[model samples]
Target: MRHADVAQIVHTIAVETNTPEETVARMYADTLDSYRADARIHDYLLLFAERKVRATLRGGNSNRH
Candidate 1:
């Protein structure tokens, strides 16, 4: 997916989960970076990042890491 699509997904997740967009963006960037070295398909990168972010936010562990 494109960067804009990923940004929109992150923004939506932030709003839906009541988290700050900036925080979500940072976490998303981190998540993306973590998988950057992997050999997985690039198209699914955002999906993986989104799931990690959503889980982290939902679990209320965002502040810890």
Candidate 2:
């Protein structure tokens, strides 16, 4: 997916989860950073990062300020 698409996904997820967009964006960036060494394709990388962001929101793993 494209960067704009990912941003939209993050925005949607943030709204749905009632979390701040900045926080979610930071988490998404962090997720991407953590997965930087992985050999997976770009699509999979975005999928995994988004999944991590979603899980973090759903599981209350984020600071949520």
Highest lDDT: which candidate?
1
Global lDDT of each candidate: 0.81, 0.79
Q: Could you tell me which residue pairs clash in candidate 1? A: none
For candidate 1, lDDT tens digit of each residue in 1-65? 77898789889989988999999999999888887777367877667778889889888553322
For model 2, residues 12-62, the per-residue Cα lDDT tens digits are: 889988999999899888887777666555647777777778878888553
Q: How close is candidate 1 to the true structure, as a TM-score?
A: 0.77
Task: Give the lDDT of residue 27 in candidate 2.
Answer: 89
Note the clash tally of each candidate: 0, 0
Candidate with the greatest TM-score versus the true structure:
1
TM-score of each: 0.77, 0.76
